[model samples]
Target: MEAVQFSPPLGYVFDPTDCELVGFYLCNKIANKPVPGIDYSIPQYDLYGSEEPWQIWNFFKQRLGEERDDQDLYFFTQLKKKTSKGSRIDCSVGTGTWQGEDGGREIVNDNMRVGTKKRFRYENKDSDQHGGWIMHEYSLDQHSDYVVCRIRKSEPALKKNKRGKCQEVDSEKKKKRSKVQEVDSEPLPLAVPPATSRTAPTTTMVQQQIQLEDETRGF
Candidate 1:
């Protein structure tokens, strides 16, 4: 018989170092919230480090078309660490310039502490553009072992519709109005009177009185 060769293991073990960062931008409304900041940092590692940075940057440049000095983009990342029991994770945010090498530059910041939140401001080097800081507040118990990051372009002030003033529509009013209209449109049925409305027939006392008068006349 031939001796059989044995293999130690078939698959690779999980490595913390092998893990990659991923991130996304929060919606304009929620961008200031804590979750977005934590979530936005992950993609930076995946986007910038996974592939050649320059190649990705070149591709981004072509897609973007024109480049400007005043624009900014933000993202977040989650850091995974190996532990005896399991993996531990933390969240962070990456924000900075966009366009050239300097444009790709980013700043990674710690996420808001549980029960406490913070906001960041962006300053434009150029004075001609309208630049302002965004405010973010962290929700309670929002932090976790996993991190979530969000990115968004600075938005202009929102304009309200000029045609109508905001008014709340109530279902109760609609229902009541419909009931009133139905009552007004339809005619009511005739009502019948009760038997009590007529006078009681001549009482038994009157009949007795007539019989007594006849008896007295015969006498």
Candidate 2:
């Protein structure tokens, strides 16, 4: 499949919930389903053994033309494995190595473990500035056979209090629904003249003339 770019929505950022990431986006990707009205979105790409973090960031920024103020980046990628039966992430990618921040965090769906989210910091061999680069690795269940990762700058403030920002989008959606209901329920009044003055009385009887044996009777 061709790589489709994902542009953030106007006046909002792309911060999907854990449930949405697993249930909606990843499920549809696994099913090869196309999302409507979304021409460009997180492209399906394998990042494990690909270019370095900076290269990946630059490539996406060129495609996006503008960086999201939120600075959180997302991608849909297939997990890299050491062997068909082995369970290890192949660490050989570009110039530097990817290091996990903490032990993987369990991302739950419907009270069941669906995937693991791991934070990574890129340590570039040539420069110390690369240490600030961060990536979020969201690997699905072993049965899923696929993964989606989010890349971003290392900022502790952005990660904290993120759920509150997500709620803003929800509130906007509710307001839209209310506006639609109000327009639908409000009746439209049409100008109508009074019925008695506007309408003429109908003629119920007509004079009739009958001739029988040269005699005529009128009632």
Best lDDT goes to which candidate? 2
Where is the poorest 10-residue window by lDDT in model 2? 205-214
The alpha-carbon lDDT assigned to residue 184 of candidate 2 equals 96
lDDT per residue as tens, model 1, 1-219: 112222213242211110122222222223453433232222232321233323333343343331531332222333344554775421211232222112111223344223323333333334211123232222223333223222222334111211111222355677889999999999788898765536766558889899999999999
Q: What Cα-based lDDT does every candidate model obtain? A: 0.33, 0.67
**lDDT (tens digit, per residue) of candidate 2 on 55-116:** 67777766666565346667887766788899887654477777778888888877898787
Compute each candidate's TM-score over C-alphas. 0.25, 0.59
Query: In candidate 2, residue 147 scores what lDDT?
Result: 72
Show where candidate 2 strays beyond 4 Å: 1-12, 37-39, 142-144, 155-219
